[model samples]
Target: MRVVTATNAVKDERQAGGLVVEVIETTSLGDRSYLVSDGEVAVVIDPQRDVDRVIAVAGRLGVRIALVLDTHVHNDYVSGGLELARLTGAEYGLAAADEVPFERRPLADGDVVQLSPRMRVRALATPGHTFHHLSYALEGAEGPVGVFTGGSLLFGTTGRTDLLGQQHSEELARHQHASAQKLASMLPDGAQIWPTHGFGSFCSATQATGDSATLGEQKWINPALTLAEGDFVEQTLAGLDAYPAYYAHMGVQNTTGPEPLDLREPVRAEPEELRSRLDHGEWVVDLRSRKAYVVSHLAGTVSLGLDGPMVTWLGWMIDWGAPITLLGESREEVGAAQRELARIGIDKFAGAAAGTPEELAADRSQLRSTPTATFSDLAAALAGDSDGFPAPEVVLDVRTNKEFAASHITGAVHIPLYELKDRLGEAPAGAVWVHCGSGYRATAATSLLEAAGRTVVLVDDTFDAAAAAGVPMTEPGESSSSS
Candidate 1:
């Protein structure tokens, strides 16, 4: 794979003659997917659940989709391969070892399929990302042209092995090294690399230099090929980091096969119907500005700002398949959120409501306001603790564990936003003051806290204000950390 490091490395489009390669970038996840075609026929590799974009591209290219090839059942996001395959009369192919309830072409190592007169693909058993993953090497009559390195050997290194669970992490890491070596041995030095996960994808074991890289260059940088297997495994395993809670569900769903997406527009709900569903305990997602949401919103609604990366937080925080009602300032905003939700196959939008607060919430008592506090306000609260420890007024830092360790308000409870849904008990019993590096994640945390009926004070200000607020910051390996 070629490592294109420029921030704009991935353009809206990239092509390769009859073998067209379109980069489908999911910025929220920092992941990349692709559509490869031989002019007459096309194949989508590791696609997201939203199939409309791929379909539109196929339509514009006048190429019929002949196959939907998944490198493996993904762990991070729902697979659209099965659904998209079924929709376009294309065969869905997965490694033979990936046992699922659905019907699909079973691919094995050394299996070569001629997609067209000039296009051919060979499946190589590159199992490290997942035990059943397959990497397809493509040849377009010009000898070995490009290789889809799925989660095998990424832009700079191989895929992480720990996503399977702790019990299998080390073993898988060893296997990952071997797989990367195996692919490098077979592919030509000049082969073009097209990876499914690149840029800042969590699936990557090491920091990816870029997406557009060569097999020859990879041999120089890829530890699996350059270092001893023992050393390679150790480094890769050490580089492993945390993934999201929703990831555990993806593989299972892809193996069993996801349901076809209902592309029909979400039904618009009247204010009365919206209120009734809220009374029934259904979810209402507010896709408005953070400022607007904290000002006046339904008592139990979760606010994920539409102006930001909306879908990832929703999938991370909300339960899958649970009915959700979307509320936006306008129909346009609701539609944007709906499209974002569709990326992860969340089609259970129960209804949509768009209007001013006074109009939507006719009962003003149902309207709840979240009060905000700056870093200085929190510092003062902590200074007054008689026990010399802040408790009753807790400073809940909801940034990533890495960020929290770098610098944070002393005695602040560290809970990354993604894990809040499962680890809500770790939050303080005292009044919670939620904040992140900035207010982006704090807004998400507020919704979760409010949903669970916990009294919370939203710390919706910048993290840099900590110094001015007298909140002491510390680097890693410091005594200030409370875990």
Candidate 2:
């Protein structure tokens, strides 16, 4: 077996058993899009936002993209399956039970998608990451060659099960454990494992250090794979991070499909056009890093730094149903930002603002800035009930379930920011107060709640402020109703 990393700067490839598997790593999300072929036909797995990358790679390799499969309905990035399939006239596939909007071939457990005489994919139903999660085992001349794990099995940890629902945790954990054991038992020791998400991914606690690892290595070192079923469940549930607020929207977008956005011809908007859209309720998503955003940003733009998990945050913070205009430092930056957001299924881009700062600045009414709250000011607000502050019952903790369970303000309703949309109806209509572990997520929650026609007071202070103010604190894993 030999591996050759594709050098196009946009695609990656490795060869085994005379089969070439090209991986298109999205610059926007770090999510990998794969093209597996044995020269004549190809199968793409979890393609990123851009179809051009896959099309170009397939053209270069002299192969056709015959089938497109999404491991599951993605929450962090949009799947390019629909776009790629439409462009190439390939069959799109989803797990048999998946209820996505597009036409798809139903892939079931043990079903094989044959690419060529020497290459094929055996679909393994590995639910729990998402209800319809599927992992693919690549069989080549070398036998069971590699496995595309998607988000079900990461390098060290497994996918967070809490994203689906709190009530589903125990059942999900049980299924996740079963899936891990099933994969472990079936895959050969030397079979390589490739995952869609890597480091810096919010989906996994930790990604594999290298791009790919072996099943044998995972058996010995992967915590989720190595632990007893019950322990695996406990550790995964315990180490869970706060689910990003954008996850729910991303799920719906992935299932329903995003409207196509063409990347080849950059859609440049004039300053007046940008302002008009903003006036009409379109949001300006500034996709620069936090430092760049802080230094300067278009007025009234929400910053989901390009350097961080921008797409994930964008899907969480921005209204998926709303139109978005992008502002980046350069054309490449804008395209990259667009690709990242597209991965999570947000394709409703009106256009990108083009030209020099001076050109954009000529229209003063068009530009606004992000509001910044100091740590001290946030602390002051949390410490004492200022004039007109709402009562304790009105306070809402908008952090993740894990974060709220870890520590939270007394009498605050526990509403993980990701679940805010579904749970918002449960919140009392008047004077709802919200806070997160820090000010960032809280600000995002406040913005959404405000947009929903609810009056919200944002608590941007640190957790210690609650303690200093004699507000009772509940440790994580304790019932919110407990004192």
Candidate 3:
């Protein structure tokens, strides 16, 4: 584990003694899959549901995939390890303690998976991210090169412990602490740490910082290493936030052997079918920019733009296994969204339509638009003048609880975007203006509110621009405005 620069640039490939470790990033899901090869043979770790990417990498490197391993039963994207193994005629591996229906090369603590004469992976039971999580230390003839930590030890923090359940969180936190310490002691200080989660995934207890790190570097920055076990457990639990609701299905899908991904184009939908799906309350996702969506869209279609975290938020907001139809500006856009959804096990679509809002609409009557605003506009509105824009009866902040607690518009109603689906009744009636940290979540919130028959305006501006726009802000527990 050579010390790379302290900058955020993460190299897609790193060199070991005689091996090349290629990083396959799923930025949308905020996870990384690795293809570690000894030139002639390779081992893929923590692949996503779309195994094609891993296969493509292996083919490009001209290496035969000899083994596919999972650090744990993932709770984020469905694991592609099983399917990748089956496709490549490679042995699938995981903790022997994990009870999965599929047959795998069950690996226990200290099990060695020899990849070549000079390269091998030594499995170490590193439970706490899950009950039976295992981290793989990639060893070269000289010594260990790096460790594939999965969710056990991230760059700056550990994986969240509550995904299994709150009842087990404290106990797991203790295990997580011990696990991180164990890795620190077993591996050399210079061994590079390759983690599967924590780039931006909710799997991390807190957002992990830094793009790369060594065991020596992490010992100074990672809470699991710096804090006492009890302090680490308490801090880890307190830092946990709401993860995507779709996570509840991933572990089960992984353990049962996820179905091979279906990247084939979905059934082409007509305007009439699109309207019917919307009418019946099926999820009709609009894959355009929020700016375009605000100007016009099919009524009731949710705004999960392709340019943002569409997959994570859509997977979080939609009812699992619900009929979903995609509406995009082009076939490519629809295809791209479909591929991303597949990574999270959203394999089937009710239908998909590619066209402009006008073309997708059966009639002009089916089209609708919402107003857009900025905090400056809201500031003016509060002063009884808004350049003819209607003054909002309610200022709705759709940012997360932590964000709202840190700072928000004075007198704004707080409802996180995820909760808006069920808490629509809690929103005050009349003209409402919604916003989030950025315009993305706010755009989604506006469409949701509008579909529920509320008059909504989207604040399509960054939150940092609020104070500069002369909007009064307040922090929670403060009696007076901050600025």
Candidate 4:
């Protein structure tokens, strides 16, 4: 078997009679996912949080993705496995015993999957980092080649086994040791190791020094593998940094399927066609970063700030089934934006505004503008008294539950903007005041709540301001009406 190294170093290419592997690097999160294929059929591995890159790669290669295999349910970020499967109509597969929420082909230990005549994958249950983790060994003409070690083993360290529960500390360590030893003994010395996470990822205690490694080398230098199982378990659990607050939620979301995002459909509109569609009351989503959006953006376009948490924000703001248009810096950017949005289950792309900003601006009558609020304005609004308003009882805090729990205005109703729609019944009706950690999300929430026929007020205040204003706040463990 011949091993080929794939990294985020380049773009798509057609090689070996259309058998190609493309690595799409999502720089926003410094994450990489691979698309492996042999012309007629393809499979995606450890899909990034965004599904757009995979879709674009598949489209360019003229191949249909038949399956999506996630190395494991990730903790650092959300998974796009389900989203990719939905978009490509491919079957999603996970380790046989995985407890994730979506239906998938349960890949068992020692199960061999054929991608083509020459390319095949053998599933090896490697469950140190996570109970359901699996690594695939690639086989070709000569023998077994590289293994895709999701989080089980990296260049320098092994996947942390402390995540599941404190009680499993000993079990995880023992399992991890046995699994690593098993892999080392079974694979040839020359077999390559490809890990899902490299540096800057919290999954591995020790960051990878190189992108890839050999099984023989890892066996000698990897601390976890060299130690006794008991010591290995204890050491792995001791030095772990605090897991990110979002990990728990992300885990559950991956297991139970995240709610769908509302992405606009891709439109190829002429000036007239674009204008007619806009007149018919379709929403325009500008999927650019906050910085790019601030410098300049289209008129009548709502800024979703396609930067951090792109899919999640889009899912919360855009309408799932509405006709929409995109305003991106380039065609590739627009396409990437579309695919990422789709992964979260948003598939409506009405088309992009086809020309330069000035060209699209030729018809002034077709445009409207959304003004951004300043921090000062937001503070003033929050501090202002609402006693004279028709309904003074409604106060909505839009931050995460943890952020809200640490400290928040007492008696304020809590409805995270992301979970706002489903939890709408929890919101008090009439003249509701909404505030997030800052004003950005509050503006979006205000617009949504108002559209739902509730009178809403946008509060401009940082969390500190609320505290200083003598607004009664809730401590982390304290139960309140909001919780």
Best by TM-score: 3
lDDT at position 341, candidate 4: 55
Q: What TM-score would every model get versus the actual structure?
A: 0.84, 0.71, 0.96, 0.55
Candidate 2 or 4, higher TM-score? 2
Estimate, for each residue in 1-483, the C-alpha lDDT of model 1 and write its tens digit. 122221245543333434677677777666777777776787778888888878887887798988888898887777888889888999988899888888899999998878887777899998888887899988776767778888888887777788888788788877888888887789888777888775666777767886477789888877877999888878877766676656777777777778876656689887778778878877788888899988888877788888766777777776767898888888888877776776566766788888877678858877888877777777766677423323436678888766776787777788899889789888868788888977988998988898788888787889988878787776666777566
Quick one: how many clashes does candidate 3 have?
Answer: 0
Give the runs in model 2 whose Cα sits over 4 Å from its true position: 4-16, 99-103, 205-209, 253-261, 264-269, 272-282, 289-293, 363-483
Q: Which 10 residues in a row give candidate 1 its minimum summed lDDT?
A: 1-10
lDDT of 2 by residue, 344-382 (tens): 655557788744344555476444333344334334445
The whole-model lDDT of each prediction reads 0.78, 0.70, 0.89, 0.66
Model 2 earns a TM-score of 0.71
At residue 312, give the lDDT of candidate 1: 72
Worst 10 residues of 2 by lDDT: 368-377
Residue 212 local lDDT, model 3: 84
lDDT of each residue in 1-483, candidate 4, tens digit only: 222324345433322333455666554443457776666678788886567767887888788898789877776557888878988799888887877666898998898888778677788999887887898886654567667787877887877776776688568777878888888988987776767765545567545666657898887888766888878776776655444334555567678776545444466666666566655646655566544543454444555645545555555444446676776656676776776655444455667853454456548654432233333433344467434433345778888655776677667887777777557677866667777886656755664564355665556456667655556667766777755
Report the Cα lDDT for residue 459, model 4: 65
Best by lDDT: 3
User: What's the CA error at residue 442 for candidate 3, in Å?
Assistant: 0.6
